[model samples]
Structure formats: C-alpha cells, structure tokens
Target: MLRRSWHHVTRAASGIRWYVHELMGDTAYAKYVARHETLHPGVEPLTERAFWRQRTDEAERAPVARCC
Candidate 1:
C-alpha cells in the first residue's frame, strides 16, 4: 500500500534507519546508501518545508547547468 507523504517522512525514516543498519553490513548497499546520503548532507526528518526548499533551490540552480 502507498502511504501518505507525511506518513512517509515521519514514519518511513524509521524503516529506512533499520534498513540502512542492515545495509551497512553489506558492502554494496552500504556504498549505495553512502552515495545517496551525499546528495543531502544535513537532511533530517524530511519535513515538507525542507523538501520544498530543496526542490526550489534545485529548480533555481538547474538552468545554469546548461545541460542538453
């Protein structure tokens, strides 16, 4: 079942926390988590405010990249 976004941010991180703990024990998943973690250096709780702020910041920065 698909959970609401709020539920995801509030509750899902706990699931991820434990999953990451298990993943950390494995070399491949640990590296994947590390790379994924790097994209957000200080994300916590993943609140709506922070999510929108990051999205807005990315949107503002995107045009300057001039990618095809």
Candidate 2:
C-alpha cells in the first residue's frame, strides 16, 4: 500500500540522517549522555560544550597521526 511504502521511506531517511550525524560527530554528545546514564546512573553527563572541551583537550594532550 502507499502508506506502507511511505513509512518505509521515512524510516530509511531517518536512518540515513542518524548515520550522517554520527559520521559528523554531531551525535557525540547524545552518545556520551546515553553512555553516562548507563555507566553512572546517579551522575550527570557533561554538557555538550564541556564534552567538546574535554575531548579537544585530551586530543591535544595525545596527538594522533593524520595526513596533512
């Protein structure tokens, strides 16, 4: 039916959006929040700004090889 096909298309588009968000690190905070909730149920996860700052600081502390 047309409704079923439309549903499938919308689901596929949602999945693609999630994948792109993951690839671009836009969902990092969301993932971090989930992980924090799971691992430390009573603790609060860092805000997005704080999370990015921490990530950047850690990366700077331990640089990785990358093509220039």
Candidate 3:
C-alpha cells in the first residue's frame, strides 16, 4: 500500500509538471520536432534557438493584442 501510494503521488507530480511546462510553452520545441519529423521525415528540424527566434520574429511581424 505504501509503494502504491508513493507511485500515485509521483505520477500526480509528473502530470502537474507537464501541465506547467505546457502552459509556459516549454514543450513547444518538443512538439514542433515531433510534428516536423512526421511531416518532413528526411529534413532536419530547426535548432531550439532558431525555432524561438523565428517564432519571436513572426509574432513581432504580426502583433496580437492580448491582455497579458
């Protein structure tokens, strides 16, 4: 019972961590890489730094008004 309870606690913590990372866009590159691999198997995906720069540039070019 103790081991099972510990396992549940660890799983819950992992889920919460994943949720926070996703909320903060920390998983964007990982998701991008997965999609890129599926869509363009032969091509190399962009580096994380390049990916963020490109994303930032695109956002800047097309500004969106948000109540942030």
> For model 1, how big is the CA root-mean-square deviation?
14.1
The TM-score-based order of candidates, best leading, equals 3, 2, 1
Which prediction has the highest lDDT against the true structure?
3
Give per-residue CA lDDT, model 1, range 4-32, as digits (tens). 77787878789888799777643444454
How do the residues 11-60 of candidate 3 rate in per-residue lDDT, one tens digit apiece? 99999999999999998999999999999999999999999999999989
lDDT (Cα atoms) of all candidates against the true structure: 0.65, 0.93, 0.97
| Angstrom error at residue 52, model 1 | 0.2
Could you tell me the TM-score of candidate 3?
A: 0.72
What overall lDDT, based on C-alpha atoms, would model 1 receive against the true structure?
A: 0.65
TM-score (all chains, Cα) for each model? 0.28, 0.64, 0.72
lDDT of 1 at 22: 78
- Residue 1, model 2, lDDT: 100
> Which whole-number lDDT from 0 to 100 does residue 5 have in model 2?
100
